[model samples]
Target: MKNTYFFLLVIIVQFTNAQDYYFPERNESWQPISPVEASIDSNKLDAVIAFAKANEYSGSRDLRIAILEGFKSEPFHEIQGPTKKRGGPAGMILKNGKLVTQWGDTKRVDMTFSVTKSFLSTVAGLAVDQGLIANVDDKVQSYVWDDTFAGRHNSQITWSQLLQQNSAWQGTLFGGQDWADRPPREGGIDDWKYAKPATPGTVMEYNDVRVNVLAYSLLQVWRQPLPQVLKEHVMDRIGASTTWRWYGYKDAWVDVDGLQMKSVTGGGHSGAGMFINTEDMARFGMLFLKNGKWNDQQLISSEWIDAAITPSQPNVNYGFMWWLNQKGPRHWNGVGEDVFYAAGFGGNFIVVDRKNDLVVVTRWLEPSKIGVFMKNLIDAF
Candidate 1:
């Protein structure tokens, strides 16, 4: 949390002082993609920014340049409106131990949903690095308990199955009410019971119950809340001070009785919304680039990262919480091999290009022009 309050100070500080950290010109650094027209196209920029604000997020866009100094640098001096948009998180790049791209509100934090699952995957990677769980194939029931009449499927799903969203236990069988009051496992089929497994790898159904169930069970295995454990093993390693929380949000994802609910104190998926700004995400991405190592410390085993990013089932283009680069379009960054990304519902992304040794993050509108934006943003790199 060091210098975290700096963001609060930025809110009130002299504008000139705050301007220093924003993007500046460098001959060989990254450049931003802005509207190009007469008089700098302020009107078009405003329109684009306005649309982003209305549909995607509440912050601004901060741009930066990544430089290899004399060798190569990204020269994007023309960045505007993306600023302070999307709740204004910071963004930056580091190459060869030098600051390349840097921009707005690095100290600030915001909710970047589904992206939280990617963070969880990173944490699980750490657990794997620690040999806490045997492997991805280990039956999740070995770590979690459903305590329902359909408990037979408890051990049927694997940790990989839950992350891949291939978990077939539908929450609808619980009739949307078990989310509030989970029935006992011994009880006969009730409205609050887990849907019978429809075959683990047969089909894909995005369910939060599987995710929360995985989280609860992992806690039983780790014997600690995930955020606390991650603080020590993951967050602290990347020099992040942002306090990501998860509490009451999981009602959309799990079966929680009063007892289980009380134990969490309501951090849920909102807690899943890791509040760290974009710069921190880049740092975390650096860990992946280094094969989950940083400064001689292998924070997470490369093996785990490999498993986490690799598609578990053949058809699903998802891994853990990371988005598998699905083949579709020739994007702006110019598509190549299938890349993996940590993406939130809106345009929030931490795109990791292992093939290119690059990670491009964007906090765009939730429903905005994310696909095109990603193509353009990466193209600049």
Candidate 2:
């Protein structure tokens, strides 16, 4: 009897999944507000709808909304549900072209992962903007504590190569992630061994190892963690705040041995530029779109903003950590050649369209097949 009941439940889910519709979270009496926007490319939309309808058993959508409840609502959180429970596809639109804002949760903080890379690029730009560093073309060994060469594979690398992510610093003999787990220098943290060399601009391998290298080198030059730099230039300009919240039950995280334990400009470390909410993320997009203008004051220069979006790689459409879609759509040039995005693993995205002034944020479950969920939601926009 129990098996029969479970099969019936599965059949019910399959039945609902066959419908070409999305279910946003609401009370039993809650009703959906239909989307308001121009239709996406018709044929493309139809294809997505067909695919979603056909994949009823693949994944279930977790959609929720509470209009006007403000940022204090519990919705702007890391979804701890199953792999199908979506996070922030949690989107917004601004009259001034701001996006993923207005649903509130603007200042609430959360992990942005590689989206943190975009913030790191912002710091790199500021470093160049100020006289802190000369240019992105300088030698990274010259900036940070180097010594990667005293070994094989890498000996002399340049800052431009690091920014371009061509630093062939073989991370781990096993794999990149294994190498990242244990950095080579000081036995301290993963920012070690950037002192090695690379082919400069000749190769293109997408690397997260380079992201930490930029962080460490910036610390050497900026004389502070990237978080402090971001607090002043990036976060403060957009009115984002920071706090050291309690963990489990003990003392709040503070400096260990008088230096900050570790920091991530874009991944893992919650404090190292991780704890920002969607509204702040939207303002960040706006900052880039308006050429680094927050209201009346000019923060980062327009030239800097333009340079940040311009592609910086021969192999990938990336500029300092920001992804660009220069291939102009309708091509298989890797992940939407027309829709430039800031991608974070575990399904977090900030899709920016400057031509249309649109930014879409989708925080979803990976491991689960929520890609269809994302494509459907994006189709409606």
Candidate that scores best on TM-score: 1
* Model 2 regions lying over 4 Å from their true place: 1-89, 98-108, 145-155, 170-198, 241-261, 269-273, 328-339, 365-381
Deviating ranges (above 4 Å) for candidate 1: 1-90, 93-99, 102-104, 145-150, 170-197, 246-272, 314-316, 328-333, 366-368
Kindly provide the TM-score of model 2 when superposed on the true structure, using C-alpha atoms.
0.60
State the lDDT at 226 in candidate 2. Answer: 65
RMSD of candidate 2 to true structure, Å? 17.0
Q: What is the lDDT of residue 229 in candidate 1?
A: 78
lDDT of 1 by residue, 147-248 (tens): 521455544777777677776644422122223222334544543344454677665555544555555556656666677777788767666545545442
Question: Who wins the lDDT comparison?
Answer: 1
| Residue 310 of model 2, lDDT score | 69
Please give, for residues 1-381, the per-residue lDDT of candidate 2 as tens digits. 999999999999977643322211211111222233333454554454444334432222322121112112212222221121223333344323422223323334445556777777788889888977776666666665555322444546666666666666554211123133223335433243344334557765555545565665666677755676777776765654343111110111224346753334344322223544565565577667556766556889887777667676564477767777666321223234445667664445566655555555544334133345444545545
